[model samples]
Target: MKNSREIIVDILLKVEKEGTYLQLLLKKELDGFESLDKSFITEVATGAMKRQITIDYIINEVSTIKINKMKPFIRNLLRMSVYQLKYLDKIPAHAVIDEAVKLTKKKGYATLTKFVNAVLRNVDRQDIILPDDDLSVKYSIAPWIIDSWSVTYGPVIAEKIANELSANRAKVSARINTLKTTKTDLINFLVNESVIPLPGNIYPDEYLYLNGVNDIASMKSFAEGLFTIQDESAGIVSHVVNPLAGEYILDLCSAPGGKSTHLAQLSQNQANIISTDIFEHKIDLVKKNASRLGAGSICAELYDEKDIDKFVGRFDKVLIDVPCSGLGLLKRKPDINFNRNEYHIAQINATQKSIAKTAASFLKPGGSLVYSTCTLNKTENELMVDYISALGLVPDCTLIDYVPDMFKEFVSGGHVTIFPFVANTDGFFIAKFKK
Candidate 1:
């Protein structure tokens, strides 16, 4: 039987080579292994990615060759070994080095096994001097990002945010479907399975840090549609939308239906929701979520921006959760930082503006329109709100000021910017407007 470290290194190599999501690939591979539990596997995968920069830096300092010049597999191997040494406590230090050396030997690099063992042992002896307080060097985030965030949020806040992004693992949160079960009832049910559901401070129905459960999909409550997995910030959108019963609502770019279905739930399934996405496959996904959650009033559709004239002024409320650079979700998807650049940011901003403009056209006079994205970029968030306001359709100032208490800290320039570090949720931006 292979140890978890060996298997994780193999999976990491495959992820780097194939350009797959490290988290997803790790989940699939670890789930297939009979001996390992979800918690242990999650720790290994996330630990490696979170400390990637520090691990690489240490490897470069110790290795005879430059770090980037090394093969992807060898680099990932070094990363996995260092993660075990520096982060994981249950795995003995000797076992960590032993497994890594074995892996190198098995790969026909028998000559390098001694070198691998020597490097790890040296690391254990504290030969590598890790920068203790340097923000960019310690947190493994790019220096430019640190500078940008510092300018926007100040030095202390920026450092905190960067540290949080590089922190261990994120908590899993789920909202109880009040349309189906009370929060009390849901908590009681989970408690029976050795899971303790804690109340989320921001939302009345959300639960955080529930123990003893790994995959929510396998839970009876999830299968019965009594709850849905959603970030605390994401769960805030439906409340902000504040859909009323018997109203005609449109959810543009509603795929996976997290917000759209929540809107129906808020309306007690009485509101008529026309959920549309550009992709046909995503329409089905929305429909599936609607059915499972018992939100029959939602009608999923495949739509194009050019066809908006047909449904002009038809909805009393319109929700446009437009796509953007996704800067807000760096903690959840660290690879985005490596892949995103100024050019991609500019392109995404243009698309977001276009989407907001088109969605605004469907709002009936005196109707509400909510523009949102899972990004913190000002160009996509505040600027889009400004563009819509310039169209002579300003947001309801009274309603905008009446943001929930949990998000009051983020209400700047009449828009909500939810930082994962500040809010203990995913990075999100939401603004409510009216015709």
Candidate 2:
């Protein structure tokens, strides 16, 4: 059987070669490794991906041969080994180097095994110098992403935003079901099993900074549907919507049902919520979450947003959490930075405008429409909101000032923008409007 290091190395190579998401690919690779804990596997995979740019820089700086000219497998192997040496403090440096050398030799790269060992040794002895002033290194993001962020948030805030995205993300957070159990009861339950959870300010249901509970799906509370894993920022959206019992609500573009489920829960499962998504598979996800949360009022459907005539003036409240460039979530999904571009941004903005317009069509006179995205780009957030307003749908500005006291820190110019660094949650933009 392969050891933990070997499994991690193989996973990293697949991620580097196939451009697969590290989380999904690593989960699949480690599925059968029952003896290995999920946390350890997550650490290895996430650590390697997080430090990829720095690893490539180090490899290039030390190698006698050009890194790009090296075989793909060899380059990946070096990156994995170097990541372990630099980040896994529990592992002895000598053992990391020795194992890497052994792996290189066994792979028939005997000619380069000595070179690999020498390079790692030199790296261990020196303080790594990253380009702190360069936008790419400072943000630990690709050049294109840094440039895009600068255009969106301005250079100074963009630099801060980029720096935050590169930092270690907090553990997954979840909102405990008050209908089933209290937060204290849930914390005590997790504590009995060595997991620690803390209170979150974003909502009464939220618990933040949870650790040692990576396999939360397997926990008794989770299986019993006593809680649902959601980001604090997302939970805040449902609060902003503030659904009431018996109200007719529409969740436009709702899928994977994060906010919709929360809306149902907040309404005591008494609201009528028509949850719509563009894809059939995602509609199923909404149904599953609603079922798990015991929220039967959330009706899921697959429908295109551009065709709003079917639901014109139907809902008392509407949530338009449109698709976006996902810039606000860079810390959680680093790969997006590597793949997204200017053209993609423009396309997403157009989509956001279309969806916002369609969602507005469903809101009855004096009804509220909440617009949101997991992105910081003005084109996706503020501009989209402005476009909807230009159609003669003005927002209740007083409502903006009345954002829950818990989220006062995130409110800016009548909109809520959550920064990952400041909020310890995914970056999000939220605005509420009324017709």
Clash number by candidate, in order? 0, 0
lDDT of 1 by residue, 220-260 (tens): 87888888888777877787788898899999989989999
- Provide TM-scores for the models: 0.92, 0.91
Candidate 2 at 186: error in angstroms? 2.1
lDDT of each: 0.78, 0.78
Clashing pairs in 2: none
Candidate 1 TM-score over all chains jointly: 0.92
| Candidate 1 positional error at 43, Å | 2.2
